[model samples]
Target chain A: MATLKDVAKLAGLTTSTVSRVINNRGYISENTRKKVDDAMKDLNYHPNEAARSLRMKSTNTIGLIVPHVSHPYFAEMISNLEARAYEKGYKILLCNSQCIHEREEEYIRMCINHKVAGIILCSGSVALDVFDGVDVPVITIERFLDNRTASIECDNKQGGALAAEKLIECGCKHLLHVGNIGTLSMPADMRTEGFREVCERKKIPFVEIYTEDTQYYRMEYDEMLENVLQKYPETDGMFVNSDVIAAQTLQTCRKFHISVPDQLKIIGFDDTNIAQLTTPQLTTIHQPVKEMAEIAINLLNDSVAGKLVAKRTVLPVNLIERETT
Target chain B: MATLKDVAKLAGLTTSTVSRVINNRGYISENTRKKVDDAMKDLNYHPNEAARSLRMKSTNTIGLIVPHVSHPYFAEMISNLEARAYEKGYKILLCNSQCIHEREEEYIRMCINHKVAGIILCSGSVALDVFDGVDVPVITIERFLDNRTASIECDNKQGGALAAEKLIECGCKHLLHVGNIGTLSMPADMRTEGFREVCERKKIPFVEIYTEDTQYYRMEYDEMLENVLQKYPETDGMFVNSDVIAAQTLQTCRKFHISVPDQLKIIGFDDTNIAQLTTPQLTTIHQPVKEMAEIAINLLNDSVAGKLVAKRTVLPVNLIERETT
Candidate 1:
């Protein structure tokens, strides 16, 4: 590893002058800057970001905590977020909590200790009081922790309504909404609310089934979905809360010899890659993942700069009609 | 935001004693350590990792660069790697290079500047000279660069041979092997070699098709796959290199009305989530991703400790029988 002294000696300059050139702390002539740059390049010198961050009391890094990276939705979100953050001269400290409370807490504390510029929380099981005494700017996606933390989420209510309306338009008589357990009271609960309201207003019979917390964590809904199908043989259409579940529903329908789009029209949420990979393809609600990621990064940056940001930001969702409907 | 001095004041101890307790440096009485810990909790104190890292000249972080995080194969790898690294008390600095040389270069420089303990490279398109002068231990997965850099990969050739043997046993008369462009010479190229050797030894007719670099990065192989099917309509069995491409192949087969496992048996590689999400569930080769990740981290740690580690580590792969075959 080459040090500042080596570069300075090679460039025939003082160590302080070289430091100023590297840090851009003071103005230097173009000729002197080029000389220092060439010298550093020749020596393969990289300035220590740890020392620089300590002096600046901050780092060009953001801590992003998600429940699981292997999930299609979070995987897509992380990809978009990493690209957007890199575009703005930032890096991501990736943390996969796997929905463990203690792990999430440890990651949060680690971010604070490292003096990260901000944190983006996309984990589902984080408690509301987790950010009570945190000093760094915290922004969450698809999760509303509390009134103090800024949040960005797609319009879950509108998404649910869109799915219901699409199913009804397809002549679905009895509707089913598969969702997360209602006890969490998450922003996603709005999805069920929207689905039920649309069904009731149109005088259509509907039922909502909540999945256990374990199902969400394991990303498996096959057994539960099979039971749902067996219990509701009269169900003409179904709206699944996530594409992962919707994909499984497609498989389950096959097992029961129920044809999709013919016997039971299906619509999924979060138009991730899994939607298109299914056999008949899936009609889904697009969550505006790329746009939401961009907005989340911008909001974190603004909050870190001491600017007052909106408490809650909701973007619109649209229905994508595919072969399933 | 509470400083060491604040914790010391609250604990009724000198700053030196509090610092010793926080760093776990020189021995301190259990009673004094308890008082310091309680005060830190009360004051909500978080030690500055940046300052500590500066003093130690290394950070408890590993840089992980992958071509695309959204791809199911990489997504699962990342999830496993993060969990393993967390157990070892290290964080991951994630970089989605998207196969751009400049972005990969920038990430490598950033990791070096931050003084990460090691780097795990899972990217497909990185140049061999990228790590020419990198100071940290560089480990490659599924891609072999130079002898100087350590590499870890599953037994890809054996995976390819297994896929071929299974398709033969399933009563396939003709075969096809789909793979990446051969110019890159990645460790995954052995898949093609193994497939071809099996077909030749069995005296079975087979064809090999290579996807363009653009197709690999975009994760879309519909058009090319459509061409392959049309060109080789007699092909009764196929082995795709990755589960992502295999999923797309399944959809393409549907478009052409080709029945899977009846008229044409199919086997995919990597056994990622996409394999299960697809209808008929792909029968494919399973890479030991978790084991590979654990070994990669261990090798990096040992190399960083100045221990002589193996230049190349290869783990075994197994065939998972699903519905497709």
Candidate 2:
């Protein structure tokens, strides 16, 4: 195992200064910290946990709790988060909770027990009881609760408004909204509220189709889309829940001969890679994932450094016009 | 910091039995081992590495090296490999080698220094000269590197033959195969060779498009597919290299009024999830990913457990005909 002595030798720093930098004590300059961390990563050195505990105390690592890393949305979010966190010189230990809220709560407790610098929660926004109990700094994504700590998210209301306005401008008179909105999820509420407000403002008639349950992410969604299209044959424009749903909706539309942007103008949210790979492509709302991830990591860094984090960090959203709308 | 004593106490076992079970040294029964491991996982018990080193002297973890996990081909492979490895009681530490020879070399060295039980080389069919120096068991996927250790893969030539046969059955006459054929890679050669040989048997003229260098993996393939269609207006069949390329081709066909299976018959290799999600769906060769992954992990585990590995395991492939054919 490489020690502080070897790291100091490689970083060209005195043992005391290396200790100061690693420990975040003795008022060491920022340059020394970079040199020390670069040397450590190069050396593939993991400081002894007990020894570091006795010396500097914290490992400066943050744990990110995501439901699944393989899903497109979470994968894109994690890629952005990883890039931003790597730029900030923090190593991320990603835990795939796999939608088990109890498992997510366990990981949170585990990170706290391991003295992780901070925690970023992205899995379940419905469970506030667990997050409220967390004593350490917690950064959230796409949801906020009780004005605790920090959160970075795109303006979901603005995103929903953009989708509504685009579909309206595309001459979609008979409109329908398809989504799963059974829970008190903040982002969902914001989006639906903005959508309803826009419809009221325009005095356009619209119908909302809520998916079966609050737990509906992507399981059995292709069937649900088929049913929605079959039930609403006269619907001209549909603002489906996500890009995944929008892609499936387009497939269903083709099955029923509802030509897109002519007979039907469809819009989705998230603007993930799946949106681009669609045949006509997707005119969806773009969540500033990279910027939000960067902000989340920055807030975690600040909180870990014993600085105050902003109550809410709001990023902008934009409408990406492709072939769908 | 729960130790063997805590775990054994919780599981109603002696510390020595728990230690033996964890180390896999002595003849502890399976029932006892299962009980001990369950208790450990339940109580978040992590074993002492140094203590295990003094006894068995090997970390019971394997390193899985892949090019990128975001790609559907490798992502499906990783999922299969992880499930197989986890079933065999081995934790996989993923290393994304980015398909660079230097990165592969570096990760091999990293795996060695970390004393992982074995390494599963998925991306790079590493040169024998590079791995001959490493003092660990290596399992290479998708290759038959003769005179080396164990290798397990699906039959690529048979898969290619099936693809050609499917397209031919769809009444495709003027067809083209898009892939690579060179001294460096064997899979692409096998596929193209199988395709050409079949076309020769049928006395049908065929065109070949090759991807140069690492461009086969990520080459902005939509434009390439469009260019191919533009060049070969009479072409009615496509034997794509992978499922991703096939998906892109399938999506591109919709733009030109070229209906899949009606005007053009397309066959994709690697029956990944994307194959089922495509609009017309895909008739592709299923490369027994689960069986191949299980055999690879089995070879690695058998080698690490001081048992002889089955040399040059070959699994079968099948053509799944869906709407595309």
Candidate 3:
């Protein structure tokens, strides 16, 4: 029964301040926020979005579909995206598609029907057909969906090249490149392309290995690493597609009694938390996760507002040299 | 301009199968799902949630509020929760409060306003006052809000006791327990309490250290570890609150020229991905994140359906020993 005006009057603040607290649009000091919240509570003001939807014809929510948040790269990216969305008066409806095409399609359908302002797909499954004829504003991360869709991604090609260059500079004669098998057709495959280019140009003998995509399950990484090690026993350096894979490689190297840098120099991509957690902290290609996330949200907001945005935004990546190299 | 019946007929499947594909409620074979999807696409049949919501008078969505998903534990938990929710025809609206009380409170208010059928709070901050007089069914993880809100948590006290016992059994005379400074009053603080109890009962000389909650910001962990090592140079064993912290401890120990297991036995809680990624893989208390997430969702659903649910659900924890111990 209580309105925003009453709550603002009670809290001695403007209605915009009270609206900001409800929408989480902008910064409000803790003291001001708490006072407004207390006043709203005291007045039993329940400003439910369901009611607002009927009048406004929209909800302040964005749908975010990721392969899986348990993966460190996506997890950190989702964290950044959620923070930026909240600052811009939007919340994320999270769907972990687990890289399944059917599941990703289902989430896209759900988003289209849920009246969310827009959708952000952090998947690389090349399944843009699901969004066909859907009117919702769609923004993608790390994958190029279609001509109509806006996307933000770190330069995977540049990242891969940086890794290859670093390993070669470290005098790695016999190199190995490990990547997720599922990401072969996605933009991330550029990492492998870049790595291969450097290896070919430098006249370095290198082997390319594609491992299964899953990361967290026990012993899978060990098994993959074992197969790679047995097949390429002469490998003196490796460039992994992601930090998680690089960490597993470091662990496997330890098991095989291979000293890093001295025997097997390693470089990883997407410098997520795992890069630092590893013993000889990974020298990785630092994907601009926060920057990409912010840009994705901004593009999504622009699209939702019926404004034209760039078709593709490529952020920069840098090589962070740490103990691993 | 197409319908479920039309798609089902074209796909040569029952309408229920097509409905399952649309709602994603039950298990459908991948082949059947694809056939149905192809039929729907060919017919331009877009089954969205808005129409379903208007008919059912409820949306199949849950609002999940966590401090941040970049933290390994929360990321894994969100992954599990999303999987379970999708299996039951629900999606997650994610809010990362970033451990700010005002931000978290704002999220709760927004959830109350939104059409999400339920809300799950994965925050440790005890600011339940924000939920006062809210109508939505609420469930919390790892923090007890009130009698009205059902909560699920791994036994932090038992986890702490296990950590202490393991350290002592490993011949650690001088021990240390490190935890987040912000969780001092929450249920997680029970870990510290249990560790202290074991130390007091065994008469082991132990020191307690609390660090700021922010992580992944460069040099904070280093500074915290520097201060801890400077103050307690004789510490032979440690029980860190989380695997992330344990990894930092291990890295700091390496810098300080301390060998793990031999000179400094260490154990961490949350047995998250970081537990295995580290070089000397951490021995940690395993919190059944998936099981807890499933239970939390079930309770929220029960409450949403106007059924009474238990006030508290405490899951079990296990001690997983590895190289660190």
Top lDDT: which candidate number? Answer: 1
Summarize candidate 2's per-residue lDDT along A65-133 as a digit string, tens digits: 776555556666765775576456454545656566666665665565445567888876635655443
Q: Any runs in candidate 3 off by more than 4 Å, and if so which?
A: A3-42, A55-57, A182-184, A214-219, B1-57, B182-184, B215-219
Model 2 chain A lDDT-worst window of ten: A48-57
Question: How well is each residue in B1-325 modelled by candidate 3, as lDDT tens digits?
Answer: 7888999999999998888777665577889978997897799786656556545545778989887788888889999999888877688989887777777887777776666788898875645566676677888898768755688888999999999999999999999888756543577889988888898999998888876656532324777887898789899999988888889888899888999988999998898888888989999999999999999888987887789898999998999999999
Go through the candidates in order and give each one's DockQ. Answer: 0.79, 0.17, 0.63
| Per-residue accuracy of model 2 over B130-230 as CA lDDT, tens digit each | 55545567887875454555877788778778888878877888988887634357544688877888889988788988765455545357878899899
Q: Evaluate all candidate structures by whole-model CA lDDT and list the values in order.
A: 0.88, 0.72, 0.82
| Highest TM-score against the true fold, candidate | 1
Cα error, candidate 1, residue A155 (Å):
0.9
Residue A280 Cα positional deviation in candidate 1, in Å, after optimal superposition: 1.3
TM-score of each: 0.91, 0.78, 0.90
TM-score of 2: 0.78
Candidate 3 structure quality by residue, lDDT tens digits, A1-325: 7888999999999999898876656578889988987897789787756655544556778989888788888888998998899877788999888878777877787676777888898775656566677777788787767665687878888988888888888888899888756543677878888888888898998888776656432225778787898889899999988888888889889989999978899998888977877889999999999999899888988887778899989888999999888
- Superior candidate under TM-score, 1 versus 3: 1
Kindly give the stretch of ten consecutive residues in candidate 2 chain B with the minimal lDDT sum: B48-57
Interface RMSD per candidate (angstroms) = 1.0, 5.6, 2.1
Ranking by TM-score: 1, 3, 2
